[model samples]
Target: MKTGTNNKFWKYAKIITFLLTAFVVILSGCVDEEQNETESGNTTNNSQEITGTTNNQGTTGGDYIYGTAKVKSIQIVTLESFPVQVQVIAKGYLPDGCTKIDEIKNEGEGNAFNITISTKRPKGAFCTQVITNFTETIPLEVRGLKAGNYTVNVNGVNGSFELPVDNVPEETPGSMSTKQQIITEADNGTSISIENESTFYLKLKENPTTGYSWELNLSQGLNNISGEYCPPEQPEGIKQPLVGAEGVHLWEIKAVSKGNQQVMGIYKRPWEKVTGKEENFILNVEIV
Candidate 1:
């Protein structure tokens, strides 16, 4: 009788153990599903994702894998000398390294710009590095408007910026003097050392017609004297003015401190969900 009792106890124990194991598996599966759902909320296809950069040298044809980066926002700001300022914000969840923005244009029919911010491969860069997500802002210049209406769109979202009569610059070109030194796209990775307070003129190449623009990532210690979009310089040998020509983004930064600070920019489309980063640039400045 004791032997029979022992057998019964062992059988019941086995059944309970099996039930617990099944329960654990089911619970684990549920937890995994929840995580995936949350990620998918702002997620797109890995192929279309622009969160970070990869070391692989791929083309737009999907031959290679690029970092996922896309647009976050685009807005137009009206300041003293700047009549039309396009501010762009892009994100790279995975950044390969620092990439320079190639171009930003106005591609849309009604004053739309396309932003082309891509990584600049070094002399021997394989570009396989993929870092985590970080946000970047790039500024583009826009000018020559007749004080009318315009639209700045990012990731399919539109931000309307108006140039009121009061914000217009003086008609007499010689009356106003610019106190800014410009910083262009080529100034990336370069450092500037200053003793007293100084200002910078940041000019970047942009094509706003394709829905891309630039903006200054607001920071402390640096005073913004002015920001504006200057009209594209008329290319030589061209007679007629092009409707949407290549342009330059002009931004002025006043450094008021005497230490080290890093300036950043991001080029992206703001409306779509992303998995990687757009193009990014980091500028180092020293005030001594």
Candidate 2:
């Protein structure tokens, strides 16, 4: 009874100081819920390392911005006079999801995208010894590529190359060059007649003096008449009759077509008048 043992030791020291202040307020709410679950698992592992390696996916990394593109340059000049300068460089890469597209060059027929420089020998004709041995082919099309990696730059004269663009297909329109078969014949004749099985012949002679001469006939058979005659178009001292021998005469004959045809020719005045004589005669026919 020392005073009932000091009021039972201050009621067990205020219940052990209120159970150690409720165990430090439940250990500061369990360390603030384990520091908000370790800051939400480090923000979900940094958003899964930015959506696992990004190259346009992960919303862009390499300064990503999708859509809108154009890179075009093409030049080819060959009039063929032969000092031989052939330079052709073409490049076109458009990838931004190709929408409502408007322009793209070099696509003129079958497997379209062409650069041809040919030489059997005779474009401007001058070859002592320069045949370089050339061949070039580049065909490509790009429209709305959205699957990754695209870069192309092609420059000529052997300088500039950087090409790597993938997957782009769906543009078909290329194939042309077929409109060449013109046969026009009209004759009011003092002497002119031609029947064709059709090997190929083009002749126009308007006699009065040599003004036109063009002949192309490779030869097959039956009534083939060769031609040359020109005179009388007046050009100084007017006493002319010697330019393959007489005016308004043009002839083109090629034979190798056989079926039914006739050729007869006659233009007289040049059995003697030396210096370059004139007088014509030809009558060749085969009709069977």
Candidate 3:
């Protein structure tokens, strides 16, 4: 009976040892798997952080990042007046709600204009993943350019426009074009006939240094284009122009309608009340 009891006790001890060893092995495998998963997650996060820092084109005010805008289309609009004016309409999209148009730069070379539209957004700010639409109207500096076909590039979108004539005005009396007509104070109180849609210049003498200027009034059939003050010519030996000297007040007018038109001017200080004794000039024009 003693030998049988000892044999049973040894068997039981062997079974207990085998179960403890299996439990330890399983626990060690679980721990190693968890560590490997944690290491892999950290590596992925580090790679994303590096990419985010290197992809931006630039930074603004140490808080914003700059990127190029995505332009979709462009339209060219030309005004219907002298010394032609051109405007460009650009349409584009933004990547997110937080992104906004930052700047627009235009550089002209030869007959081509290159325009850059830039975008800005706060760095690392959470924004809606929605697309936004944008439109911008920009004017071109075409004053000195000769008449021809010109190309415009706005953020890689291309367009073209044509200027049938030079976009420069007749600035001097000796340089007047065939289409420009001249009138002086000597023509006041006289009636003249001109072609329809013709442009005329009214040159009058005044002394603005005394706080007096020419106030012009146009009839409904005419259009007052522009008025400018021409300073008196300085003597050859004199370096500075004469003070309180006489100057010419030049006005550019257009006859848009046929029939009778009138241009009237009154010389007086703007703050002073007008009286019948104030000097005045008038002209009658017939457009046919």
Candidate 4:
């Protein structure tokens, strides 16, 4: 009975040891499986992140790949008391490969500039706002211009358009019309018949310091000719053969007779010592 009990005790101890060893082996295998799952999950997440980053870079880089862009159109809105709008279509393209990135309201010193006009005033006025990487619409006010034709220039590019303004009279307050008159009389001294009366004036310039005097001779056809005559003289009444004014002096002559007669008048500005006649500087008059 003592030997049997001892044998039973040893058999139970061996069975217990076997069970414990089996539990340890199973636990180690489970731990290794868990570690492998965690490492695999981390590798999958890292690969996904790299793919996403590469896709975003490709989309952004493709935008400027071709290196060509165009300005589609330009519009102007006039913001005067009355709103007037104008549209312009651009025929040419802009710099190549310019992709629109962003835009905003602009307020800076170097951005503003002045436009000069050779005429009275500009046909249109406006404030220009700029945009980056994209086409933009501008605004303008039309004023102080005629309702005919006009042009607008941006940088060096030019465009033609029309303006809507009242047609004001071309004559201004200070503007003066030139006056011109021409009178010719026949040789008949008894009765003077006016031949031509045109209001057109000619240029007359003379220098009287060199003993130059204009002579008026009456035609022999008329008699009893008389009128007030003003010979060319200096404002200070300085005699010829001396320095005088450099302008033609005006004179008036008239004649009357009982019978029909012819008269002639000649204006002579002769050299002082020389006997030959000097050239006559004609006068022009304009009629109103």
The per-candidate count of clashes, in order, stands at 74, 23, 0, 42
- What TM-score do all the candidates reach, one by one? 0.34, 0.24, 0.45, 0.23
Model 2: ten consecutive residues of lowest lDDT = 77-86
Off by over 4 Å in 2: 1-8, 22-28, 38-219, 222-253, 256-288
Worst 10 residues of 1 by lDDT: 59-68
TM-score preference between candidates 2 and 3, better one: 3
Query: How does model 3 fare in lDDT?
Result: 0.86
Candidate 2, residue 62: how far the Cα is off, in Å: 22
lDDT of candidate 2 over 27-137, digit per residue (tens): 999999999999999999998887685523633432322332232454332211111122343434432231212322333232223322211222232345522221233
- Write down the worst ten-residue block by lDDT for model 3: 53-62
Identify the leading candidate in terms of lDDT.
3
In model 3, the clashing pairs are none
Order the candidates by TM-score, highest first: 3, 1, 2, 4
Give the number of colliding residue pairs in candidate 4.
Answer: 42
Stretches of candidate 3 above 4 Å error? Answer: 1-62, 173-288
lDDT of 4: 0.39
What does the lDDT come to for candidate 1? 0.59
